[model samples]
Structure formats: structure tokens, C-alpha cells
Target: MAAREYGQYCGLTQALELVGERWALLIVRDLLVGPRRYGELAAGLPRIPTNILAARLKELQAAGIIRRAPRSRIVIYELTPYGHELEPVVLALGAWGFKAMGDPRDEQIITPDSMTMALRTAFRPEVAVTLPATAYGARFGPAELVVRVDGSTLDVTRGDGPVDVAFAAGPDIRRIISGELAPDRAIATGVVEVLRGRGELLDRFASTFHLAA
Candidate 1:
């Protein structure tokens, strides 16, 4: 059970009581990337206090949203089947919140899990199916990802790979994702830097992965 409860009998109330505490859903978000050790989760969410992380883990385990499994003499946290069902919900929530994300605060930092979910949220498979298969090696500050789109499928992973375009950007990449800035303009204004590969492929990237703000 969660540390705090709403004392109501509604479904939404029940759901909130289960995972509504601060940093709870964020823990879920990181676990969606894959199983992670306790330290890994802490590292991904650097700002979360250690005690809060421990309590949230216990609460989630009690609700069957997550489970601990022993691996190589260590314990790791992974989402349960019921927890995996939150994928669509989290993605939708992320998309909704993205509309209000104008800029990153000075202290805010991007993590691999968050970036992976962002790519998944912005991917337009219907539009991608009509274009040539492409890949992008993207570096947003210290976070890096290889975004691959084939037909209507998309795969994003941490690290660089053979890609049509390899570009770097800061949080302003949201401008391109929101279609608020054209790719050429983004490049011209120094909002994005082409590290390697043809710069024109950025146009393809902008088309394949976008979310209307």
C-alpha cells in the first residue's frame, strides 16, 4: 500500500493511491526502459532522495506494479505484467505534458530512459511508412541515442551507429519535434549541429518524428 491514501472507493482514486506519490510514476517510467538495479534507478533520477526511492519501491512491490528479481548475486527491479500495461498511459501522459514543456530549467537534465520514451512518444509510424528507412545518431547534451525507423517500426537505443544523419542539440530539439522550427532553419540558426552525415537527412528526421505542439 502507498504511504498515503485518498480514503475513496473510485477506480481513479485507487489508481492514484497506488502510484500517485511524488517520484512514483517517474520510477515506473525508468523501469519501462528495462530492469534496473537500485543504484541504476537512483543514477537515472539523480534528484530523487534515496529514502524516497526505497519507500516507493516498497509501495510499488506491494501493489504488484513491480518486482525484485535476483540477478548475478544482486537484485534488480522490473515492471510486472500489470505494470507494463502502463506503457501506453505513460506515453500518452508524456505527450500531453510535452505540449507545455517550453524550455528546460537550468537544473533539469535528460536521461537515457526519458529520451527513449520521448522518441517513442513523437514517432509517427503512419508518416514513416511512406519514407525511406532511416537512422539517426542523436546526442542531446550527455545523452546519446541511435534512432532507427524501418517502414512503420521504430527502435531507439543508447549509443551511436551507422546512420543517415548524426546530429547534436540541446533541449531546443523540442522546437524541431514540435515543428515550430524548420530543419534548415534550425541548422542555420545553430539550434542543431550536424556532427556527421548529410545535413538534409535532418529534414527526413523532422518528418518521421514529430509531435504537434
Candidate 2:
């Protein structure tokens, strides 16, 4: 075999060289949701060593996959527009992985911000119903989200108010919507509990927000 030139490969190989590590993808995944401070990133991915994460961030920045912005005096990491294009690819891979691995019994957990973002992006407006009469709160991780389906829009938040339905689950929204956990089973197992609203309302909301075949 002839000698290989490290820099002569195509751009894809070059890109992989920077982000093909085990934790690098997860780093990108976190950034896909939104910009995060170093401490937030570290907490989100508890398995990654701090030094390695710092190194990967540096490398990704060098590769033009991410950029650092000052949230104050502190720097927060955010994906470039180029990096945002990878969202669909990452989501598809996650869907495939979920199907292949089968659903786990363990309770999944996600942040309120992440849940709201997921709903906003994945929601199909055509499937939505105008339910001005109902309001609800969903809890994920430390954040409590209040979802109000009024007229044609869906409003979600992390505060308290009058809500018709509340989804208090520990699992990530991605896993829950992908059918990794049966919503009823999650409630039955005590992994999630609803503070208000009838079962029909939850079913209607789920029908509208869940990923379709």
C-alpha cells in the first residue's frame, strides 16, 4: 500500500477526524439543543472527563463546527449554522438507535427547555387542535413546563398557572415520543404523574405531538 497523506483525504474524513470521538457526538448533541455554559455541558454529560471535553471543544472550534460566545464574562459554547444542519442527521440516528435497542425500563429524564424545543420543532401544525379551554404543566428534570394549547398555537413554559394537563415524567421527550415508553405505563409505574386534566386530553395532545410513521 502507498503512504497515506493525513491532510489529503476528503472533507468528510477531515471533519470526522475532529469529531469522531466517543463523547464528541454527545457534545454536539447538547449544543444542538442550545448554547450551554461549560458547567452546564459538564453536568449534562457526567461521564465525560473535564479535560477531554475542553480539548474536544477546542478541536471542534478549530474545525469550524462550533463557536464560543460570551454569555457574560463567561464563555458559552454554541453550534455554528453549519453545525445546526446536522440536527436531522443526529435525530434520525437517534430514532434508529432507539428502535434497534428496544425500549429500556429505566426512567428517562430531560430538561424543560429541551422538551419545549423538541415540541416546537417536531410539532405538526396540521395535526394540532385548537383547545383554548385547556392548559397544562409538564415537568422534566428540574424545570417545570406549562403548555397551553390555545387557538392555533401551543405555548410552553417553566412556571406555574392554570393548566388542564400536566406531564410529569423523568424521561427525555425524544424517548417518550419515539414510543420508548408507553405513556400510560409510565404513569402506572409512577415514573410520571399528571397533576390535572382527563386522560382524553393527554391522548389528544400526544396524538398531535408524537412522531408519525
Query: In terms of lDDT, which candidate is strongest?
Result: 1
Per-residue alpha-carbon lDDT of candidate 2 for residues 64-171, written as tens digits (9 for 90 to 100): 889999876899999999888777766665545544544435654465545665666555556665433457677776778777665557777667777677767665
Q: Which clashing pairs does model 1 show? A: none
lDDT of 2 at 107: 51
- Model 1, residue 3: distance off in Å is 2.5
Would you give me the overall lDDT of model 1? Answer: 0.93
Model 1 per-residue lDDT tens digits across residues 12-83 = 999899889999999999999899999999999999999999999999999999999999999999999999
- Tell me which residue pairs clash in candidate 2: 108-170, 108-171, 109-170, 109-171, 135-163, 135-164
Per-prediction TM-score to the true structure, in the order listed: 0.97, 0.71
Candidate 2: list runs displaced more than 4 Å: 1-15, 105-122, 129-136, 141-143, 146-162, 172-191
lDDT of each: 0.93, 0.68
